[model samples]
Target: MRIDGRARALIAADDRGLLYGDGLFETLRVRAGVCPLWDRHVARLRVGCRRLRLPPPAAGALERDRDALIAGAADAVLRITWTRGSGMRGYAPPLAATPRCVLALAPAPAIPVHWYARGIRVRFCDVRLARQPRLAGIKHLNRLEQVLARAEWRDAAIAEGLMLDTGGHVIGATAANVFAVIDDMLVTPRLDQAGVAGVGRAVLLDAFPKTRVRALRRTDLERASEVLLVSAVRGALPVRRLDARRLPVGPWAR
Candidate 1:
């Protein structure tokens, strides 16, 4: 089903997000008619707007739109998109942009509880993420890299792909952040250079005071006692395999 609201049918074909992928988006999970991470999602959305030099939308209006879209859904994946709005045929942004926002809600995928219990198998993707410090932590619309990495395998056994940055650092998975356990410390890759700073990663770090955020290399990943993938939509997912190497379940695998 399509998104419903007053703004739903107002998306223009010439919108920058559709035309040039010049926008930011957030995917949130709705449970029991409430979004647990709504504040964090709004914080990230504001940060993304600041980074992209786009105007922020009104929070109350956004909430109203979101509520309207997911009114009856018990569980849903809500995608909120914001663009620089319409403009003339040019590469430069408009002088006074009003900005366009769209909130769409749909049923979430049926993820088996066993997937988390048994852990997931992942492979090292050939796709290398470019180091764009300016756009490193923001969830922008440019995702060709992820698309290519996901296309590397069609096997259902391989749940996801771990991606490395151009500097040979383990940035993150195709759609989630990577966290490893080393000497009883939770170490995650620093997003100053690349990778999306996921909401789930932030939640874990906030919940666990001992969690350490640092730059991780390829060798660091190979030596990790435990590796897990995390995102806002999907919580923590343990990685069982990377390429031909098998990772044993450790204390943090849960």
Candidate 2:
């Protein structure tokens, strides 16, 4: 763990991220000392900085931090977190503040090989995500909604949980973006309402020009011929079952 480009474990006690969760984070999959989709992750982090009204981390600094942490690990999960440094005793941010960047590396989760080919099971989370257009599409520090949703299921059979916005529109999975193929057309939930615009989903959309971004409902998912979940760290995974609905592993998931 490194704090603000230093080999430090302690952060300011009054940091807004610790006080009020005013921060953003990006997780990257490092393979053989490289973050393959780092450019895309940085692009997302830049947008997050703009939305959160904080200065972006220097490109050079970020690269150096990545190199130092992943030097020995052949495979790792690199998390880059940025917080609106120590602030006064209120919601209003200080006039002048230095953002805090913390880089943490950990062993990547070993996903079952069959999950990539045979797919996994999922269920709808009872917790509905609140619509916050300003915070939508960014991986913000405030993730209590996801936490609650994830806690809704503890069964090992359920690999992931799908979440919906308060407006009854399907948003995404607890930790991945959800994409579906309906009527022979590919589509994903729009992030303008609520959801993270993930790098994996972005790559998929870019690779498949016919993919559409729109509001999706439970019925849409029910009618989908195939469903896939994507995360920057976990890659692509097909959904073999959603609750009682048994789905098929699609060619696109490969």
The lDDT of each candidate is 0.86, 0.92
Runs in model 2 deviating more than 4 A are none
Candidate 1: which stretches are off by over 4 Å?
1-10
Model 2, span 1-254: residue lDDT tens: 99888887888899999999999999999888889999999999999999999889976998888788899788999999999898889999988878999999999998999999799999999999999999999999999999999999879989999999999999999999999999999999998978899999999989998899999999999999999999989998999999999998977776
lDDT of 1: 0.86
How far does residue 104 in candidate 1 sit from its true spot (Å)?
1.0
Candidate of highest TM-score: 2
Give all TM-scores, in the order shown: 0.95, 0.98
Candidate 1: pairs in clash = none
